[model samples]
Target: MRESRFIAVKLISVLKPVIDRRRRLALIVDDTLMARSCSKKTELLAKVYDHDKHEVLTGYRGLTVGWSDGNTFLPVNFALMSTKKKENMIGNQPVTADQRSIAGRRRTQAQRPMNAVTVELLKQTKKVYYRYRDRLYDVKGLYERLAAAKTRQ
Candidate 1:
């Protein structure tokens, strides 16, 4: 994961010059369904709603945050959200990874609510790129958290 982040940062630096100076950078947050309907044993697989399809589906919600300047878009951070409710989960195998390991941490994070995970993705994005003129997130409580973060700094 750290390696991927490093690559994303490098990619951003390389692309920064190509972005139009007249346009402001914005943070965009959104989620999509990652269908794993056939897999019963996949880790963290859950029954998630597909807003586009307007129905429940067997999959994970891939929440992502990205940076965009009218012309170009670069993904900054993301989280795969899984339902914590046992009834909604399709895969319930216990996570055996050590708590300190990245895999374990990520597995734990997957079970958290989507809004909380989205906030975490925003925080991670903020660490990588500090300047953005606008934030495009639909989650409730996100503005409050970001404002609180700003006040702390």
Candidate 2:
């Protein structure tokens, strides 16, 4: 995750020159299903609802947040989400890593609700691109969840 952030920071620097300063920038958030239908043993694999297909499927939900200036779009950060429900989970192995370690934290994040993860992603993005603090748009219904996550911290 640290490596990915480093790369994203560098990419932003490279793209900054091309992005028009006059136009409004947007912090886009969305999720998509990464289907793994054939693999039953994949770690953290779970039953995720595919919005496009309108059905539950065996896979991970790729929750992503990106930056765009109307024309150019650059993905800033993402989390692979997994179902927390015991019955919906497919390959739910015990995470043996230390809770403070990246792998353990990532596993914990995967099981969290999408709104929580989205808040975290946005916070991380804010840290990376501090200049665009005002540009981070809150998705409808997420303000309450964001406040809850902050109080827990």
Query: Which numbered prediction scores highest in lDDT against the true structure?
Result: 2
Give lDDT: candidate 1, residue 49: 78
Candidate 2 lDDT over 1-153, as tens digits, reads 756767877987888887777977678776768999998888899988776778988998887887777787778888988978899989856456468888888888888888878978888877877655334433445567666877998
lDDT digits (tens) for residues 11-125 of candidate 1:
8788888877888888888777898878898877888877778899898887778788877777778887887788887886556646888788788888877766776777777
Q: What TM-score would every model get versus the actual structure?
A: 0.84, 0.81
Per-prediction CA RMSD (Å): 3.0, 3.0
Give the C-alpha miss distance for residue 122 in model 2, angstroms. 0.9
Q: Model 2 residue 91 lDDT? A: 88
Off by over 4 Å in 2: 133-153
- lDDT of predicted model 1: 0.77
Which ten-residue region of model 2 has the weakest summed lDDT?
132-141
How high a TM-score does candidate 1 get? 0.84
